[model samples]
Target: MAITPPSNRLWWKEPIHGIELGWIVIAFLWGLFMFFFMIAWHFIGEQNLSTETYKVKPERYQERVEAFAAEFQAQDADGQPLEENGVPVVRPPVGGDAYILARLWEFWPILELKKGESYRIHLSSADWQHGFSLQPTNINISVHPGYEHVVTLTPTGTGDFGIVCNEFCGVGHHTMTGRIRVVE
Candidate 1:
């Protein structure tokens, strides 16, 4: 029997050639493209994260929420108490901060913003974790207790958008549907 040289090496260690080499270069280029694409998408994208964020105590948050409710009790030319399903609707001033409180089976003080105007939305949970999903526009934010999730958005259209809780908080999760109205 003829003795052969030892050739115990991993497949990857073997010299790549022809189509394999082309694939390797293609994969490297694809990775580089994705790296820069994600950076721009996160930083310069419309769905970018808001840089301003802060912690909020639940009690003080509730107090602010109550005050906000009372402040907007008077309605505009459209309607008074601008509400649906008995949830108080808030039509915040143009280019201002809006707050949405998330608790069990409810997003209290439904929001109403103006079209072509920007809004800084402050979201927080009263009890457990919740997901703030704005449908049609497809914006989802995490609502955490004792912490606030802030997002800045401009309403491009005038319509009523739906808010659904995606996080499984308890048995009442299915009932946690809120509404946001955007007016022209």
Candidate 2:
């Protein structure tokens, strides 16, 4: 039913209900509580994203990614280089920097990481913005063009972790998935 104005002119003069007044006070208190809680969590939360970013040209970043991938490229059993969809599969050394480039529909250079070892993963986009979501660990960060983002992470579990794009980029957004293998 549509709301109608009070039929009586004396409606404004009526006393407020006690229950309504109590709810109003409770809501105000709850809002204040939540505001403080968020501030406290920022200081205590362990799942914070890294703020280390650098300005770099897209072409230069791509060149670095290619060189990193080639330096640590894994070989196949038949003596040829291993590649997935034309992108090399690399196994970076422990405590070293690794590079991953996000482009139109894929993330280049599948990474093989050793559990319990730390690695600095450099993430950047070649063309547009992309989302870097690491599964099981639930780490998510934004990948943008012309800026490199560095995240230092240590894998605690050994398994195949997926890197999925949470941002919608284009018609093939659903196909924008990458792989990371963590081994003991």
lDDT of 2 by residue, 28-73 (tens): 9999999998989888987677889999999999999999998999
Per-residue lDDT of candidate 1, residues 1-184 (tens digit): 3286447545567777899889999999999999999988987776666766679998888778778877875475876566667778777777787888999989988887888999888888888999999998778878888988788889899989999999998999999989888888
The C-alpha stretches of model 2 lying farther than 4 A from their native spots are 1-5, 9-15
* TM-score of every candidate: 0.79, 0.91
The C-alpha stretches of model 1 lying farther than 4 A from their native spots are 1-17, 74-83
lDDT of each: 0.84, 0.91
- Report how far off residue 160 is in candidate 2 (Å): 1.0
